[model samples]
Target: MKNLFIPHFIYWSLFMTSKENYHKVSILLSIYKVEDYLEECLDSLLNQSYHNLEIVCVDNGSPDNCGKILQKYAKKDSRIKIVTLKENRMLCGGRNAGLDHATGDFVCFVDPDDWVEKDHIKAMVDAILTKKDSLGNPYNLVLNRNAVSFMILADGSLKKMYDFGETSGEKTLNDVNLNVREDTEVPMWGRLYRKSFLDAHPDIRFLEGMNTDNIPYTFKLLAHMKRFYVIKGEENATYWRRLITPEGAITPVVLWKNMEIPICFDNLFDYLKKHHLAKNLRIPYHWFFTICFPRHKDQPRYYLRFKELMKKMEDTVKSSDVYKQEDRNLCDLLLYAPDFFNFMERYFTPVPVRISRSRIKLFGFIPFWYIRHKERKVYYDLFKIPLFKRVKTDDKEILYLFHFLPIWTRQTDRQ
Candidate 1:
């Protein structure tokens, strides 16, 4: 009788192990008041070719018909699990809620407003399972696909793939010889991630009061991953609906809020430095100073805060060998905009610059008119060259010349 009981227990344990290994992907969705587009999003997810998916939907107090829709889907599909929050939590909160409930080998976050290709999950899973790295460890892949470009009306089905090889703004889906970059970092929705990686880095949570910007969280997540996969093929996956209309989904104005952006940037910079990633952090740091910092000038307190933040960044970059030159150049450009800088200096010292706008404008237009004179030059100079090459070399001179073209032509056109 003892021998019989031992074999029975062994048999049951082996059965449970087999069952656990069968499930592959978990689709983690964070839903709010997206009733208009939620059905399409659900439909795309439900129809994925990879059937071993567990759907975890977190509803953050949607006052719309979203609750009913989620309930209906949950009832129909046993795989769909719904978690309704008591109060309206923000984007980060909703995602964390979903993360807590997820129990799959791999995870993908899909915004309720966006839809994915039928084979999106299948392609991503295949890449992760089959692909091997230099050390023979399975590649911890983050798979990204192109987004469709239709905002309000779902009728205009636009499918465009990102060609990483083409220059930042120039690459379109139509280009045949597009040289795509292998290691481009993009927003969260475009990719599928390994769940184990996320489990290892529990501290990588999204900022609650932030404008739902995924870059900070996504970058931190990707930095920890070993390999990145950019899937470019007939897969034609992930439709990112561009809301073109004024009344469509508006990006949150937290950047314009007093002290929000500077604090966020400062936090991100410190995180990078602590992790010994200050060099890679320069691009986003420069971007924040150039774009978001200027918007705060409308408010006095925020404007002063922006100057202090800039000074702090300037000092930090100066002290580190990784960011000194790039930071100096960016600081020079900010100083050149006197009216803007003058407003900023109310709380800090103004960095001085001698060049006037008129002289800068003159040299700027020459390259602009010259490049636009032919399509080849436009393609080669504007799109073909990598961003680092342009940022580091004579490309600034080219950029300066291009800047003047608009002002020069504006005068000509007015005449």
Candidate 2:
């Protein structure tokens, strides 16, 4: 009777716990030459408040002691699973290997050189489970804030010197608009993804054999997402990203590799076109035009292959209905302006006039007093004057400006 009861109890426990109630989050880490920091990274995940986690680490032929360290952790905690590769396959290849091995209800990424707060996994899991879109669908992605850390030689430790913003509260968002906005952060870390959603779109894997491979991969995810959730300042689940290391200093720019920027853009463009989601071109095209296209002239082959690619991009932007008239004019200067002027003027120019417009609002509404000014370069300060002016206030006046001369104006408490 005791033996029969044991089997029945095990079956009952399994039936009681449903996948929806308890989600298994797989934290994927690609192990490379991070032996010095590997232990701290592993410990952070192992100590996470969230218990149901699969820590998948891909040993991408690290010449350092990372492999041995991983083995040591795996023995202590069965949650740490390791996948060994014969040779170094770069970041894309290593992450792809981990993604293939991960078996969890939700998926996330972490850099072996970086570490997360103890509640990182738990915070993300709670937000994703409780939050739903307008249509009552679960969020496919969730983004959080992270801290940028720098190494300090005084104690040979990482110090958090900077914090990223835009994560104040929980909110539902449209991902395409977020991607198009210049302020949005695109790094894969500090985010959570639904495993089933990723499995449904198998082609969204990172493109291998390229530097800075996340551009195309992330753009694809943003374009396809129906809606995503963002939870800020929750349980201090910040991803601490180490910017400087002893041996891993930043690399110098390579012209040939820079050429891949357009290739990445085109890859995203073609994907959207093939799927009949060409309307989403605004996401990639915005970055290509504003950020990537301006730097193309620096390439030595600007006249050869790069020029042709720019023309193709210009045509695509011209044909798209997503851009406003201002964007089209900027593209015109990019393609038609002389190379030297375009390079210096576009790159070195301060904030354009359009972005510097100022307005006075009263309690976040229209103000009683108004002043209109014209735009001009700093060199032409003498010629600068108000384009128009309007005043509609009952307050006592102290002084005011009529055209270029001051006639009367007022000092008010509200002002």
Candidate 3:
């Protein structure tokens, strides 16, 4: 009855509208039989200082207590939303269910088994908001640099993925090009994306049932995005990625993880070819052939599968109007003579020699220089960790090994 003035109504409307300019980040958490870890992951999100969050945890019909756990969290916090399915739908389906209920300015995902640093969301939201496009709009996507991978040791100790020391800042599509061209990080998490951007590209969904789904989706997402930035999480808190899994969560034994790898490349290759991106996706091919696929030579059967895959890719490239023999020399080598590329991969990425337990008793570390693999034994001889593609910086050749002992130089000696 009092203060019926139109101005009063206008004032409240403006206040509510102004708040929307800031973010309300939606976190999509997909779970299946992750009861032991779900609550911990949820706590990490709800406790975030970036309070304007809507965490949608989809229990993809877990036959465990995961659904009940999520429901309990929802009762405590209105910010936490629970979606329970009646059947298992795997990763893609679980994600899609969460997507249906997402109502936020930006979105990111956290697996049930993973947790985050206290200020993880705050850091990501702050950095993303700090960047603007040429049109003065906020950046559409942001990458996280300070994420850590945690693995539990036999003695129950925790191991971190990367130690944060250096101060890094915001990145543009230009910055990503330099790294993306050289096989950069591609995990789905540890980043922020505008919800609107995802809505615009319906086809950008994760590859269903593919072991290396991220492999294609990550590359394609970068190629599709026009504006992006990187949040400098290195100096701040970061997401803690869980590298170990419980028994039920064990990695499925993959068949070639799909020998149809070249077929995987076909879609992206076609996209690049269609858009006159001949020069753009070469490093992508390099990433798979040299960086990703080299390690799977664990079995001679793998080599045969790769041979057929390369043959298909070679035929596609040779028959196409885009890819060239010069640019795709690696693929071309495997296509023309699969044995030669196999020989080179064997020669270059020679496995760490397996010495007698007596040798281990004598020396703490085996000097790789003494490991000269020859003849049919070369097929079985391989690096315990599949070696990274040799990268040449300035005048030096760098061979990246396992994450723990990352760099192995191929010079006369190593200091």
Candidate 4:
């Protein structure tokens, strides 16, 4: 019997030729059970103004009608390429499959539930074609703004846009002011990348796990990237549809693990240290140990692992010329948490603890309170807002007065 699968060399050559001929961006759509929104997503891609485009949609064995939708689009549009997995491969596997089949010089991964603006590809491609790095290579990663808004089917309309402005940038990971924790940095979508950069880092494959498929993969990619472009403007593109369906991948347990919590910091620190990227690792390590840790009291291991991680983090920071007094202060706070040594032992134990709902809710609010009290200046500066920026109008006051006013008066007003 003849083998059905094409050789990798043949595939690569075909892809390269296609890239040379089209000189377009490849949109990688990883579809699972997003049948409810698949058509709309595909429509957005089909309607893109960027003519030289290839849409590679990988269906990871969705039990829903998503496969059928993908097939329909593939049949209708020659540019739409569909790859249906025989078995259910999660997000990471699906994306890898799409990556394997993508043919454009630049690749953008879009969730099946999400749709991009008409100019998404044009913006990114223009930036990549025009912009060059210090080493003369085109910018490896081009980040488009992600507007978080819900698309309501009732009126077939979207709500007001919640602008997450220039969230990803070269300085984002390294900035002292931007205390970006691991959990916040690994979002897989909203960025366009060069195909060659990804090809160079084949080992940067997404982890085929429940929670953290993107963190390890993104970290490895970012470590090697030279130039990162941030596109800024009012051209609102990429509508991230927030589904209310409970059946989606995210769950409370999944969230705990996927948040990359402190464990990711440990893993990333090891990775960076192994690669001798010590200076680059310091800020992220400090943020992970200090900021991301204290927020979760329910994760006993976080508390237990505190002392050792703190020591390592302190040493790493101290050894670096970029280390600051604020970083040291943050470390001190972690070391001083109630029953510091014992907490470290219990919290860092290999075994996981059963987190109560009440504890989860309490732990959830801790970050906000901690930022307000401990790192007030850092928090304000990172958010690019002034502390005690008063509400201007009566309507605005009614909205935010409780956040600023004294507790008694706020309670009385609410009552």
Best candidate, lDDT: 2
Clashes of 3: 2
TM-score for model 4?
A: 0.65
User: Scored by CA lDDT, what does every candidate get?
Assistant: 0.59, 0.67, 0.63, 0.62
Per-residue lDDT tens digits of candidate 1, residues 1-415? 9899999999978865763356467787777888978888888889987777888988888899999999999998988889999887677778888888899998878778877778777777776676665456665555554545454545555434333221221122112112112332344565677788888889877776544546466656544553455565554355454443324443435554445566666666667667876544342555554555556535656545545656656655666554546566665544344665564564245645432221122365543211222211221133322121111122221322332232111112221
Task: Compute the lDDT of residue 190 as modeled in candidate 1.
Answer: 59
lDDT-based ranking, best first? 2, 3, 4, 1
Candidate with top TM-score is 2
**Runs off by more than 4 Å, candidate 1:** 1-23, 133-136, 153-185, 235-246, 250-261, 293-305, 319-324, 331-415
- Estimate the TM-score of every prediction: 0.65, 0.72, 0.67, 0.65
lDDT of 2 by residue, 59-165 (tens): 98899899999999999999999999989887778889989998999999988877787877778888888888778888888777644555544567666566666
Clashing pairs in 2: 399-408, 399-409, 400-407, 400-408, 400-409
Give the CA lDDT, 0 to 100, for residue 383 in model 1.
33
Q: State the lDDT of candidate 3 residue by residue for 132-152, as single tens digits.
A: 766677776777767766776
Task: Give model 3's TM-score versus the native structure.
Answer: 0.67
Error of 4 at 49 (Å): 0.9
CA lDDT for candidate 4: 0.62
Number of clashes recorded per candidate: 9, 5, 2, 7
lDDT of 4 at 210: 37
Q: Sort the candidates on TM-score, descending order.
A: 2, 3, 1, 4
Model 3 weakest lDDT span, ten residues long? 372-381
